[model samples]
Target: MALPESARLEGPILQELLALGGEERLRVLYRRLLAYFPHLDESERDCASARWRTLVQRAGARLVKKGELRREAGRWALTERGRQRAEAEKMLVEPPPEESPRRALSHEELQAMLVEIGRLLGKHAEREHERYDVVWKDSPLSPRLSHVFEVQVHGKLESALAKLKHAYDTQRSKPVLVVSDARDERRAREWLRPYFSGSFHEIG
Candidate 1:
């Protein structure tokens, strides 16, 4: 008996989806499959593209045949068997492990690692300063800080303003000033006023 369209494509599609951990939406799966094997004919990509709805139906049919996927509340999730297959395939391709270290880091060694990390970060920030309009440290209630860079172009200021507002809403701490510059300092100040609460300044 001749197989249906979805069933015909099932083996290759299932292999690809399993390789990708089998948790992707149909569209994402489709794109990744094409990216990995670009020679797959257009007809193959179109096999399930009658409509967006049809894509899921085709994927469902394919998964049903393998007995390794299930639909739960409009989302496809991998079964345990599916996860095992993915893991097996991954193990086959993974490189051999390197030799383990003789001993764990001592306190002095850990402190040296921290100092190296800070030096690398300072160099990275210096490079970013050369290429961007503004760079600032984003700190919250925690001691850790995240760096944010802003380039003024094509509504970028507006984008930065929105991001700053989001950060303020989510985090309870204030950001540090490492370096900053502005094309229109007044405009930058105006945009950041609501979010910064009068803590904006130049970094030396």
Candidate 2:
């Protein structure tokens, strides 16, 4: 039930409703995806997203039937029961599985690749807690390996990039960045090109 990031969405409607604080216009909820993936071609992505409302309605109906939410004035809001349920579920669901680091890796084999890179470059990789996810200092990978590895690791990539830029500047490291697939990498490279003309690599 989770929507793919390439589809300009993140979901399981119940989870989204919870994030919206239990109330949101169906259309507004879908638009959250657009805000994150704004660069997605309208013809391709928007056309696909056009059906989200129907999906939301279908999912929300179940919640409404369970007394978890209420529909009024064409908007949906969480009922007290829903709020309580969401809190109860949060203990089991905080740090969602979809946001895990291995998401970009199509297969388990890639984890070994990341580890090999860290070993070859003499950098340490820690998937959790600390200023950045991975750190490389004074290694040959110095500027290249020194980065906040990309993922939809945060709720919003914009927030993540902001944190990355701040860390990059404050940490007195190299400058030059961004990437995912080739298309996304190109767009990000273009964005960073004016300020940095160094080697840039794309990692899923």
Best by TM-score: 2
Q: What is the lDDT of residue 29 in candidate 2?
A: 59
TM-score of model 1 (CA atoms): 0.30
Instruction: Evaluate all candidate structures by whole-model CA lDDT and list the values in order.
Output: 0.46, 0.52
lDDT of 1 by residue, 137-187 (tens): 322243323443333334544454544444444542232221133346576
For candidate 2, report its TM-score: 0.35
Model 1 worst lDDT window (10 residues): 172-181
Q: Model 2's lDDT to the true fold?
A: 0.52
Model 2 spans with C-alpha error above 4 angstroms: 1-21, 33-48, 94-204
